[model samples]
Target: MAALFADPLHDQFGTWPVAYIPYGGADFGEIAAVAAEVGNGDDDAYHAAWIAAAERLEAEAETTLASGHESSARELYLRASVFYATSYHPLFGAPVDRRLLDAYRRQIAAFNRGLALGPHPVRPQRIPFESQAMPAYFMPAAGYETEVRPLIILNNGYDSTSIDMYFLSAVAASRRGYHSLLFEGPGQGEMLYEHGIPLRPDWEAVIGAVVDFALAHPLVDPSRIALSGTSLGGHLAPRAASVERRIAALIADPGTWSIADGFRHAFAAMFKLPPEAVADLGKLDESVMQRAEQAVRADRSMHWKVIQRGYWVHGVDNLRDYLASAELYALAGRAEQIRCPTLITQAENDPAAADAETFFAALRCPKTFMRFQANEGADGHCEMRNRSLFNRRAFDWLDEQFNVEMR
Candidate 1:
């Protein structure tokens, strides 16, 4: 019943609807509508059905707002924002596409409108990052504003947008007395589209900016701040904590040591070399690179999403360079250097299970390596299919670690 790609809506629908439902970003009817209209793996199909649903919901939201039904309007606008965010899932390789840009703008607009009507108004804030203003949201617990509270900076992964962070993580944290700061950093969400900032491997700079933003707020208890990331963030968060000493703890929801490990398998298969050999060589031949690109483009499953999305955000189109860059994103000599308490989650069905293992073995800090079973419905990447259970357990660990006093 809780299958990863069971939706049949997307070839790469691995845990998508399942992942988003708990956050109220997805529903059976809307998911089914898109599946019925758009064939999986086609970028154009995703854009059409999902955008239409978003536009329809947005019109309804505007109508409700005009009629003074602020509460209803807020919910509708949130739904519209989520739908708009979903529409451009497959159109990767830079946010330069007009249709994709429009969807992103709508997502932001709807989210902002909904936030304006909320009891605790979410500030549309920005963090300073090398002459660019990184977009963010500072959300405190519903009634805990101006109170000194433990803070959790929610970092999104490779393709997760600002909308996904709010529903899936920030609100969850706020519900549990933790103030949350949700940001769209380079290579993620609106940052890549609105600004042309690609991701940088020195993730400490990103984490540093987020921590700076969090501390600047009045509600933040600087001593109790924990930095955590999901998906690819499972790798980036730990990397950042290795250097950023200000954060008290780090959480990698599904620990990953080296992103390059993902492409090593692909390299071994394509070039008929040992995975270790590919890792050691660190680069590929031009002929092999061409063949790799063809294979990725021809793929009709999750491979297409992973490869194409990686190309755009990584700012590289050539297969060899893209895959090799993954190798550079490893904690080769830094995993042992993380000085704070760390919580690492590993899902049974994710390739990162192996990543968690390799990453955990190198830890020298106070670390907790936790696992998610397939039977628990938390087996997908980042365990988004069952975020509440994951969040409950994760936050419990955080509470204990920080000695948080719950209201």
Candidate 2:
């Protein structure tokens, strides 16, 4: 048996059934039926039940996280991450609370123990991304002692934690013998919360560093590297790929052609601040305390504006300038320069879908576009919560394109 601390699902016990047990306020029958299905060990049923539970947990966690109950939020997030991992039978995504100094120490200790214990056969090995001598977790898999497997590097969109968020996709790729890498870059889940690195506009540099790191690793198949970015990363990934010719394939889901729109929307909604105040704050080189003071006074919706301003301070320039330079909007002229096969997926309801399609149409390389309807459960954003049925279709299309069947 895996050690209790070593097992990602250990603390997640009983949550699965709880996930399906609808609270009085929630719709009951659907959750109950899902619970029953998962209890029966049917993979499809389990997944459906888990997804429903995950949706509920995410809502609660968001509330907790926003309320400053970091510990409570961490527990719920752990539950959510484990649920995703268990569905695919991977061992990763254990929660760690860094809010308290003691808890942070323990969490780091646990992480060290877990890493030493190693991963499941199908789970990618955890690699370290050293920044300023501090180690961050990364999952990397590559073709070894065989023909190089196509490398696929995945980046999470806004609010996603670690690669543990995409355990299902990672498992799918591993099953297909494709090497996969999942990293927590700046402004990503744990990285942002733990290290305060925030997001950067020059994603190409970040990814290029990762690619270079991967190439140096013995298991990575250097020539077949690919990039898959979800949500905001959808825009970031292609931008990186445009600069890094080493990437042979690119898949962007519900592309973010511009960050300006997302920034404005988030700033207005998250901090409750007017756009002008946010613009004004952008001019100042202020301390975090000052930034926080201005944020709390302005409006709650403007919290995101503060964050956006921080993004600008970190060399993104203004939001408009950043958006203007995004790959989705600007890569069209250079799309022909990419020699890799590409796949772009979009959701009808997604605000970014139009830009994704625009990018797709302009691609000079071999490419395909898949559209998902808005009413579908998993059709939001990058289809992150979509069912296996949707993913099966995507994988089949990819297989056909890559001729994996014959290989």
Candidate 3:
């Protein structure tokens, strides 16, 4: 095992592996250093190191920007944004913590500044949702700001922020002439940070709202809009697609058919209880619930990455309640409702979900299941370790489906 608290199945150092992706927008050296310090579960140490990195880099960014070196300053500022973002542990009293608030502020300021210097035209805006607005970034393909191109809506995973959608896949989509809109819904990023909204199981409502925004926007091709969900978003996106037919195509990075699989596994492995019992939270013995919650709180790895964050986002204090709420995320009868062409990508080494093949088979729509093995160094969840390779394959599929250009 990588460590006692490593992802029970992936053997990754931590549940999130915040520093695992060395792609753009992050400092590899500093990430490496902070990652090492946190390997043993020193969250305070991790937060401190990353915050220090952000402050130092942001200071440097101001200096270079003053010297008229916008290019150098842009990259530095972006890295600072990433560092500042990494400093805030979502479970660490984030609801009202000034440190988290401050970090979020820096993250946005630096990201917007850096984004303006990018090759594509980007807008940080909000999408109208029910009685409120959802945070998002719209990146029109270079030179196609006013012209309608095929639109790709990107949804980030459980712990990932809205900005992560860009570096993860939006930029790659833009390079291939696709406009990308990256957004955060309940339980993710700013929604959880700014608004007190937690995650809900009916993601179709969240997605339908975005589709409304896309269809109303002048720069979106109503007939060719696709949705790409990363990590936990694999479930969210698919859930949305199950009912939201406006989505022309769908991509589930590391296809996850059910969120219950995670809770089920954790319950069985850690507590030696039947995972299905989680369905009936009210029936669970209070003593059993206490023990399970205690186990989660005791394990530093589970505390922040899974249980604590789950509690905060799901608005539950106990693990049983959290798992009970997750039961709705399953696509039991809904998979057949997805009428759009769908692609489900899987990492050979991922533990995000089991029986993804069954989920793929369940889809009655035009579907493709693509698998990445360990040899390519792309076997981690969402292929984060080598997203370029994964994106190449995914976008190639998109290009063929949409009849777009290739390199």
Q: On residues 1-407, what C-alpha lDDT tens digit does candidate 2 reach at each position?
A: 11122222321322222322221112234334444556535334444555556556556766886887755554555445443433322111112222222322333332333333323322224334546212334344323324455656777765443433344355456556666677767766445545656566667777877787678766676766768777667777877777788887787776556554444454456567666644433332245225445554465323333333333323353433333333223454555565678878887667756677677877778888878874665554455335344456666766665555423
What is each predicted model's overall lDDT from 0 to 1? 0.79, 0.52, 0.76
Residue-pair clashes per candidate, as listed? 1, 10, 0
Model 2 regions lying over 4 Å from their true place? 1-148, 261-337, 405-407
Model 1 clashing residue pairs (backbone)? 4-15
Arranged by lDDT with the best first, the candidates are: 1, 3, 2
User: TM-score for all predictions?
Assistant: 0.93, 0.58, 0.89
For residues 1-407, what per-residue lDDT tens digits would candidate 3 score against the true structure? Answer: 13323223222422233422444666445556665655555555556766787889989998999998988888887778877876776434435577777788788888888878745535588888886699888888755667889999998888778667777887688777899988889888788877768889899999999998888888898889999989888888999999898899999987888876665666667667775665555456677778777877887667876565777788777666776787767888988889999999889878884657878999999999999887987777787667788888999898887887533
Overall local distance difference test of candidate 3: 0.76
Which ranges of candidate 3 are over 4 A from the true structure? Answer: 1-23, 33-41, 90-95, 118-121, 265-282
* Most accurate candidate by TM-score: 1
For candidate 1, lDDT tens digit of each residue in 1-407? Answer: 43222234353542354566766666766776766666443567667877888888889989988998988888888888888887776666653788888889989999998888857667698899887889988888766877989999888888888788888888788888898888989998877887777777899999998898888888899999999888888888889999999989899987888877766776688779765566543466667666666776777544545566777888876666677667678987999989899998888888865778788889999999899988997776777668788888999999998998876
lDDT of 1 at 394: 91
Evaluated at residue 62, the lDDT of candidate 2 is: 66
Off by over 4 Å in 1: 1-17, 39-41, 280-282
